[model samples]
Target: MEQTEITEILNRPYARELLGRDLTRLAYVAADGTPRAVPIAFTWNGAQIVLCTTRNSPKLPSLRRNPQVALTIDTEVHPPKILLIRGRAELDDVDGIPEEYLQMNGSYRMSAEQRVEWEAEVRSLYDGMVRIVITPTWVKLIDFETTLPSAVEELVRQRAERQNA
Candidate 1:
């Protein structure tokens, strides 16, 4: 998809809400040739989606082998709002916790004391982390209002045709 189209979709209010959400399902091919989708914390930095993980994360190898990935951020409410994104993962190894990691996790509800303890624990546990960065190449937003899943859209069109007939 064109960059402009992606930007427009992402700029939509619903899509922006999904992007503000803390969790997204990162989907990629596993090393064993199976598809894997796992919930991970992420931050959307205007131009890229950044997910931080341990340096030794199992998904690291798989991502290195196949950088292509898809991410889904959606709501659980009826007639859900979903933002789907496809991109190529670019791994960046950085010393210490990435700011994006801290920023993303900050959304979780925690008391000030609890937040301090958690930050300490996180800092002490990992000396470095890998930033799994993805610059979205394609995007789709399904609000079930202005948009929907492609198959559902097609079905709606067919139903309309039948009604007209």
Candidate 2:
């Protein structure tokens, strides 16, 4: 898709809500040439999606070998809103925990004391992390109002033709 088109979809309100969500299903090709999709915490920085993982994460090497990836952020509700994105992964080694990681998990249920304990544990456990950054090259928002599933779109077209006939 054209960059302008991608930008337009991503700028939509539904897309913005999905992007702000804590978990997105990230899909990539594994070492064995199989597709893998996993739910991960991510932060969107207007231009790119950032996910942080442990330094020795296995996914890092897979991404290094093949950076192409697809992501889906959606809601589990009637007439669900879906946002699809395609991007290339760029890895960066960061010292200490990334603030994005912490922020992404902020919505988790935790008391003030538990929150401090969790933070301390996280800080002490990991020496560094790998930042998985992706700048979206293509994007689509399926909010049912402006866009629909391919099957539904085709059905709508057929119905219109029948009515015209």
Candidate 3:
């Protein structure tokens, strides 16, 4: 998709709403040449998606081997709203805690005391974390009511043509 098209899709209210979701599924090629998808917490920084995980995360090795990835942010309700993104992952190792990691975890409903304990546990577990930044090259916004999948749209067109014939 052209940059303009992608930008327009990303700027849409529905797209922004989907992207704002705290959990998204990240899909990538594993080191063994198999496909892998995992639910992860992410934050969208206007133009890019930021995700953080431990240095020893299994997904890290796979991502390093294959930077190309796809992310799907969607709702569970009927007529779901989905934001599909394709991007290349850029890894950054940060000492101490990563701001993106904190932001990603902030969406969880936790009391002040629980939050403190959680942060302390996280800090003690890992000396550093890796930030996986993805700059989207393609973005598709699908609100089933307003926009259907391309295959479905084509099928509708075909059915209409047959009826007209």
Error of 1 at 140 (Å): 0.5
Off by over 4 Å in 3: none
lDDT of 3 by residue, 1-165 (tens): 788898899999999888788999999999889999999999999989999988899989898888999999999998889899999999999998898898889989999999999999998988999999999999888898779989999999999999999
Q: What is each predicted model's overall lDDT from 0 to 1? A: 0.97, 0.91, 0.92
Best by lDDT: 1
Worst lDDT window (10 residues) for model 3?
A: 138-147
* Residue 100 in candidate 1, Cα distance off native in Å: 0.5
**lDDT tens string, model 1, 1-165?**
999999999999999999999999999999999999999999999999999999999999999999999999999999999999999999999999999999999999999999999999999999999999999999999999999899999999999999999
Regions of model 1 farther than 4 Å from truth: none
Which is better, 1 or 3, measured by lDDT?
1
Arrange candidates by TM-score, descending.
1, 3, 2
State the weakest 10-residue window (summed lDDT) of model 2. Answer: 1-10
Number of the candidate with higher lDDT, 1 or 2 = 1
Q: Please give the clash total of every predicted structure, in order.
A: 0, 0, 0
**Weakest 10 consecutive residues of candidate 1 by summed lDDT:** 8-17
TM-score winner, 1 or 3: 1
